[model samples]
Target: MICVTLGRGRHRTLLEEWGQAAEAGAELVELRIDCLRSEINLKRLLTDRRTPIVFTVRRGADGGLWRGNEEKRLLLLREAIVTGVEYVDLELDIAKSIPRFGKTKRIVSYHNFRETPADLDTIAEQAREANADVVKIATMAKSVADASRILEAAARSSEKVPTVGIAMGPLGVFTRVLGRKFGAPFTFAGFNPERIFAPGMLQFDELRRDYGYERINAQTEVYAVLGDPIAHSLSPAVHNAAFQKLGINAVYVPLLIPNGKLRDSLDLLSWLDIKGMSVTIPHKEAILPMLRQADGAVDRLKACNTVVIKDKVWTGHNTDYHAAMGVLEEAYGGATSDEVSVLMDKQVLILGAGGVARTIAYGLSRRGAGVAITNRDDERAARVAAEVGCRHISWAARASTPCDILINGTPVGMHPNVDESPVPPAAFRAGMVVFDTIYHPENTMFLKLARERECRTISGVDMFVRQAALQFTLFTGKNAPDDLMRQVVARKLGVTRD
Candidate 1:
């Protein structure tokens, strides 16, 4: 079940939104009385409550907006309990003071905006000892390990008492979706996606539609995309949709593991029994060495974008290599029996010398295509070109260099930066095949220019879906719903094409 948190300054607005939340399929709502500008009118708000509510009167210290005295805050909590609110959220320090009354259950919660405390188990026990019917722990998670620690504590405490463990921020999203597996009764979500009720609080619709949170249970296998700056990833939506379509009992989430923290997160990810993961950005190459064993793609590209764990062993694979080759082949007029010979003698110019760039360069090089790499950082471009046995092209000379195909491995034309293009307009010649690996905006400025120049275009959507579909198969050992995966990604990206 998902609880929608509603915080409005006016009672009328609050009541209207409460009904709206119900209409939107909210099973529960949290009435944050602390946000009211006027005096509290418990009877007026509770009279015709449309859904079960977790009544909360928060103070500033606990990431709430209440600016009144503690005495008044405590009085409001007690009054709500006396008025028979379904649940009341009391902070750990004051949980003992609020006596349990009637049928109102006590949700003793702890909120630390700074960091997840080291003694989370001790805090959970304290909430339990304070007569909490449900213990809620919300803290700022600095790393994946911090989120893991909160999850571990919740799993342990739930065996004895019901516990809701949440680590705030993008890194902690897993806990909210996977908390039920650790025995949380229900997780909190914001009624409005645009509102900032709490850091990292997912909107009700997002949890329901994108994550399929209601379907998650202890038995549901967990998979996630791990990387830094993971906020824009559409992998979760794509994979989760495929899981639902294929009737696979699993959930995929986005985890922001910043650079230098991947090694530390390995044990924690294993501890959570994550069945698989999709690695992105900086970690792709970093993860290659950590794998117990890897496929030929990983060995050749020196990068691992997919990982499947079994019996505590992590096996890595590079789905990007195959996905890129497949899409490029199809765009180049379908694959042949000798796929490697298709691109032979063709000159390919690749933009950005990152992981994706490296993968494409190696694939093209292996297929006997002449490849040249260019980046804003000339040194990195030169280094990658040397590693892939490809020639280096200066950023200044990229547009003038003659090539039959253009591959954008950089994020230069991704969402929000949709107007930016790595290559100049003159670079796109007629009959050239242009491919942009940034999928968020299906038609990037780079692709648009290429189209205007009469070049055959391939958007990142095709590659992303193909790669994610491959990951789905690796995760479940089942043929992926390719059409469904493409549709989900296209719909989320607001594009009509596959």
Candidate 2:
């Protein structure tokens, strides 16, 4: 439905313009009092409107021109509510402060004027708390990338709350078109240039006819990657691209679930008809206990990389285990017989024990590799080792003896930390193989030390591609276009293939 915003100081011409817009098929009027002088009256507009009205007195923090005092803002908002405008645009921050507003449906909003927040989960948390009729997030967008991040966040719980994503720049133009795909109820468009209310806003006709966005449907399938600081994920890009290629009508997105809400957040997928999800980062392990059931590698490894809902039942598995192992084995000279033997022996030294450890240990154990786990956090190292029935050693004890193979499962030697190897040169032995699971730097000090010792050395880039290839397979259910997937992952990771 069309809602023509009344410009500031346009009070003298409001009634006549409203009639013209209505005649042109605008369905309702939106009074943007934030753009108007304080003297312009909501009571007067309510008195004249035969059509319903939505009133908003947005603050400057929210990309609005409202420079008025907080007391004055609240006063105006209260007046609009008391007068009972059909809808009132209220910042979710202020709306949740009071027990209630008068009869109007509140279009509660969130805005990020700075660079997009690393976590969209926090934004969703704010919306969950606001309890508004709808939730809106406007992020200052510098590229289609930034816009996509916001659109992805809105996609996570569209059925729960009709969300709005306002991308405020030229790169943000795609937002209006993609908004519908993500269940965004409406997009902000400008009628004129100087008076353009938002950045990258287009005219309503342009949005309707040119962009071709439509109302969200109840049957649309949902999917997303849940994590904290989740704004930069490319699963939406990769998965959505795959969907378009395969002609799947499904949509995949990203959601920030904060640290504590992994269960409540992923539950949105089940409640909203989400068929599948791409889990990442901290959420990967945290989401383990939330699944209705987990089988296959997930049952043994106790880590799940993919969760699929069938007949409303959530089934989980760790595709990453085989993926990463396959990649590492393929890259490390097609995997030595000893490497194959280590998984069953429980004698391999794993230098890092984070999420990747889940895949590494699980994969190696399945292959009969004996694993030993260690980390900076001794307790965490112990936990991982105990779970896999591998022995644990302190970081200081790394030089004690040569294990069958030393795997760098941590990011100590990654790009920014390229100089920091988890294991020192003294930790290397001439006969042992070393695997540094840091893909970005290509080779870490650990791998270099192993190389200098004339020992077998392998890079982490292989493991990354292998894990991603598995995800690609699970996502498409077809053999991952191996060459294409490899190129895609290599190019994206700035790594070259074997």
Best by TM-score: 1
lDDT of 1: 0.89
Compose the digit string of candidate 1's lDDT tens values, residues 155-259. Answer: 898988899999998899878889987799999998776677778888788889889998998899889999988976889988999899988899999988889
Q: Give the TM-score of candidate 2.
A: 0.56
lDDT top scorer: 1
The runs of at least 3 residues in candidate 2 whose Cα sits more than 4 Å from the true structure, single-residue gaps closed, are: 1-61, 64-178, 182-221, 244-247, 269-272, 328-347, 377-380, 426-432, 440-458, 494-498
User: lDDT for every model?
Assistant: 0.89, 0.66
- Candidate 2 lDDT tens digits, 259-334: 7767754443343466777676777777677688986778777667788777777778786677666654554456
Instruction: Return the clash pairs for model 1, or none.
Output: none
Please give the lDDT score for candidate 2: 0.66
